[model samples]
Target: MSTIDIIGLDGYENAYPRELSGGMRQRVGFARALAVEPEILCMDEPFSALDVLTAENLRSELLRLWQAGDVPTTAVLIVTHGIEEAVSLADRVVILGGDPGHVRTTLPINLPHPRNRKSALFQQITDLVYTILSEKDYEVSPDDIAVLNQGMYATFQPAPASDSFQQAASLSQRKPKSSRSEPFEAFETARPTNLDISEEWAPNQDSPLRYPQLPAVRIGSVTGLLSFIAEDDVDLYVLGQRLQLDVDDLYPLIEAANILGLIELNEGDARISAKGQRFVGASIDERKHMIRIAALSAPEARLVAQIYRLLSQAAKQELPEDLIFDTILLKHFSPLKARKQLDIAIEWGRYAELFGYEAPTGTLFLDRGDEPAE
Candidate 1:
């Protein structure tokens, strides 16, 4: 009767786990926990999977038990990503920070019991928690991200440029050019005409030979983010906080936008640029043109262009995807990383309409529909 009163699972006690809905199963689990009569109950993401109404009801019932001193547990500790949920339930919220993750801060929620979500005090505390979580000291340096076209999986780093001629001579002697064929030769020779080989290889540049991990987000997401920012001037950290985006989810989008000159980040504030504004206003076709123009600066774009040129020159407009996968990407990256990089390249290329990929046929080709910009 006590369990049924708390969880409200009256007639469905006999229902198996497989037969019950997710919420019903969750309620059953809670009832089981209460049945254990433990002194302390610790829940990790307790309501994360439930429907909004069900989660709210469960929270209310738990609070009822905690306030009335009905449960065996004198204390309840919940680990949750939801800021609002924490503010609603916890008397004190302790946040963990850093790479290894340590105690950052413990915040006390002073709001009265049965907190009203719409109240200004609740909002204020929620915002405070967000500010604390998104502390500016944790910001990622743009330079810390690696450069593209560099070999991430290389066994040895190249020595100083003074040793380059000697290294090349030794390499030439050690391995004859005749032994390398097809894909390897093609990939090596596919360097863009406009690419500055000397500049890329210059030893003066810091970490020039490191591979860049591309943004995990798609072009639509990039555009959507820009449009979202264009509506208002926002601090990057605060914006991320409101959206519940962590460093990993938010930083890459910022980096990608920064690289394309679409958004400017100044002291953690993100504002859409003139180019970004134009992009937001443009039609689908014109936006593709913009993506092409901005993306030209990337090494991946140049490499794709080079490949397209080679294939066109050979009167072979289409090439098997496996050829490039094995020769170029796999040489520098692990199979997983290579696939990720290839997907990035594909996204960029398709946005620019520089190339088309047919997954069914496992082929890549220059898209004839994408004519030169006027």
Candidate 2:
């Protein structure tokens, strides 16, 4: 008599045979077979009596145990009637033909775990196997033959939208390098001649411009103001220098925020609006999501910043200066468009007073504190 427990059933030793369900009785038979610590375990339609879900569960449990290396180094072989179940559970599938059950074909499945039935490769293999089975010289009804023929082409194809990543990458790579270069010239020409400290900094109350939607500038400005308010008005020039943006780019964002009742901008200094303060209080993920949504909605420097944020997040770090060109290419934007977008973000930063250039190292920093007007 077998002494080993099946499916962790050692505690049920005294249970009456009549009390167990068919599945439990099947498990008992399995336990008895395992008792002698056989070097090999063969399951011959052991799951046939169980429901589909129970059979699948048992198959998974068996595979897990086999992988755990706890059971005495035993090789397992399972026989099943369902083709999908056979494919799922077997390392190799063997089909029998002829009246005496002679082996007709053997197929090796080398797919990795967590296989997707909907993949092209899975369908291909299933079709190939069905074709092999259909070639046997047995008489079959026309309906059965038609069903087998359809199984040969059963496959899933994803919608066109699923190809965005590839399309985006291809589009970015094809853009000319010269298109990206002209924007920097525009930025260089746009820098302020005299730092106008006395200009009445009324909040630009206009609805954000639609086309040439430049949201990054606004976001940078708001970020700068938030940093400034959080750190105490430090130095204006230092803040500008830190954010690597021109004053022009910085001003509009702050102005936009003021329009939206999100911040207060005054004489080269900015403080958060009540809404802005609440925005800052949101979780980091929420803030990023909001920034992305807002950037998508309007023409502001924030859009450019959102793109940079996406690239940075995807790359898992700040992009190197030299690689920025290549990164733009990967985004599917023409080099010109990418350069325009990036320059827009940088310029907007400068305008919003969120960024400034370091004369010594030339590195941009997120200058939160206020700087005295240069």
Candidate 3:
């Protein structure tokens, strides 16, 4: 009964699963998870199925209870894709990435209780996490986050560039040439020592490469983000509020823009790059040309360029969209994850005019190029 009251399902205790709304069902899940009084509570995308308001409400309730010492667990471990949620809830945020899923870096969240997402310090802290996760800096000490709580948000020390991944170029079974009508710059990368073949996309192996990991976000939203900033510096927290985006919804958009070289992040502010200003001003055709050049330059999956290169190697210069999944994305991600990643890649490629697709048949092929503008 106490658990029922805690989850707001007190009167629905006797109700069957089918009799309750989806949010109610989620509340019941919370009740069950809490009933046992486990030492460490684990939640995997707990609110993913709930509507936005319900998720917010539930998160609020849980936060309230945790602060009040009503939560039974000694620790709460959440595996989430929401960047802000992690920062909001944890004392320490552990980010995991790469093919085999290693800890990219862990940072301390030193904010006071009942955190304010709108606080300037909060925004800067979130940006630091984004920086670590985006740039894939493994050697970065956890102490890096210490600067934020000390009121020093201006500068960041990028640890020395570590060894490059050996899997990117050397693992390619053959050096396939781009066969498009207007050929693209080759996927120029250093050959590391290995002959491994796997479906997971490799990060860029450029000798001096230092990119934030590609946030799992789509090209459309990223374009929208660029349009939102429009050549001005905007506070990221206010940016989130103006867009009515939760901390998580806006992370990908920010990371994508930063990684694509369209924006620069500093002290919780996002400043549009000169390239971004041009992207905002360019004609539709010109935008595609620019994105084509930028995205291909992305080391993460060579997002657009690599796909175009692969299609060229195909006998028909095209293949079922799912084929890329089997050959490149699947070995590292589950089918659903692979599909989501490929879908975004397809969206960006199609938007960049790097490739074309037939949705009904899931076919992906090269799109004719208008040479990218300088």
Candidate 4:
């Protein structure tokens, strides 16, 4: 019976008995016991020597082997002091009470596999188990009660602002000096020698440029930027709701990018300018380079470039419709982080060019060199 492949212990059979730890010896003993392929496998505190994490792993492995039909046992009987271990591994849990250890009650755990810890049923069971354990004769002092009360009070206090402070500090460090000031001053000071024809054609305004800091990234911003470019018109309120953002969080970045000549906003419509178009058209590596450049000259444009890169990377094979927006949020940023970045992107990132496709009513038409823009 001890010579079988139970728990795959055959490979370690050559080791001297003295060399094995208590846990290893117990495992070997279990394997040897199962070698007989008995009708029933009985374990008396089998995992008593193993740590909690290791015991859980071993238990899972044993369950897997049982499910695989290798074990001939009709049933498994295990004795353990741990209620959680019993609840996790056993089909029926028998609770013993009294100093001599007599059966108090038998509990049938009807919960399905991969039981949810957050479920109400699990919580109820946990509370019952805790109550049963606490019922055993134990002394409680005023000091203990005071300590417990202190712990409860601590929970209600707001958590320290270290994380938020660190984030703000890091963002401040990453922010170029110009992002906080008038971007046009820097742009005029270092005007490019080879200005594009479109830049020369656009009218210049003397409006006081207001640069609002972006809150964070958003999914709606990506969709809105795409729509604004493609449709040439979008409702501010509708776009705000789509991106799960407020108008206050969305407008600043958009306006800033417009001021920096990265995007154009006219007739209640937002569109990417020629400079913005070139940046998006560039390769991923090149886009990042342009982003740094835009950030120095215009932080809003830099943000827009980053959003476009995220969208491009996310939409690998197919256009990432609103359905996959959450996925992108999770992949690139945390739920909290996503909200922040998206808010920033929408507010600052330049819009892209969007093109629509329509089929003729009766006849099919094909055009060359007119690929639809994503």
Point out where model 3 deviates above 4 Å: 1-218, 230-232, 369-374
* CA lDDT of each prediction against the hidden true structure: 0.58, 0.45, 0.59, 0.44
lDDT of each residue in 243-356, candidate 2, tens digit only: 555677555555555543455556766555444443443322223333433332333333344433333343343334335445333344566676555555544333333333
Q: 311 in model 1: Cα distance from truth in Å?
A: 4.5
lDDT of 1 by residue, 1-374 (tens): 57644454443433345535565577678888988787888898988986443464356556655665657788899999999889768878888886888887776666554455555565666776777778745432333122111113222332221110111112222332232332222322232334443245323335646545567555545654663363245788876775567888888778877766678787878887656655544433445666665555554344444445544544567788787676466656799987877767666666566666766676777656543433
Candidate 1 stretches greater than 4 Å from native: 1-207, 230-233, 299-314
Question: Candidates' TM-scores?
Answer: 0.44, 0.35, 0.43, 0.34
Against the true structure, candidate 4 reaches a TM-score of 0.34
The lDDT, on a scale of 0 to 1, for candidate 3 is 0.59
Better of 2 and 3 by TM-score: 3
Taking the tens digit of each residue's C-alpha lDDT, what string does model 4 give over 167-219? 11122123323333534333333423233422322223453443233444321
Which TM-score value belongs to model 2?
0.35
Q: Using lDDT, rank the candidates from best to worst.
A: 3, 1, 2, 4
What is candidate 1's CA lDDT for residue 114?
42
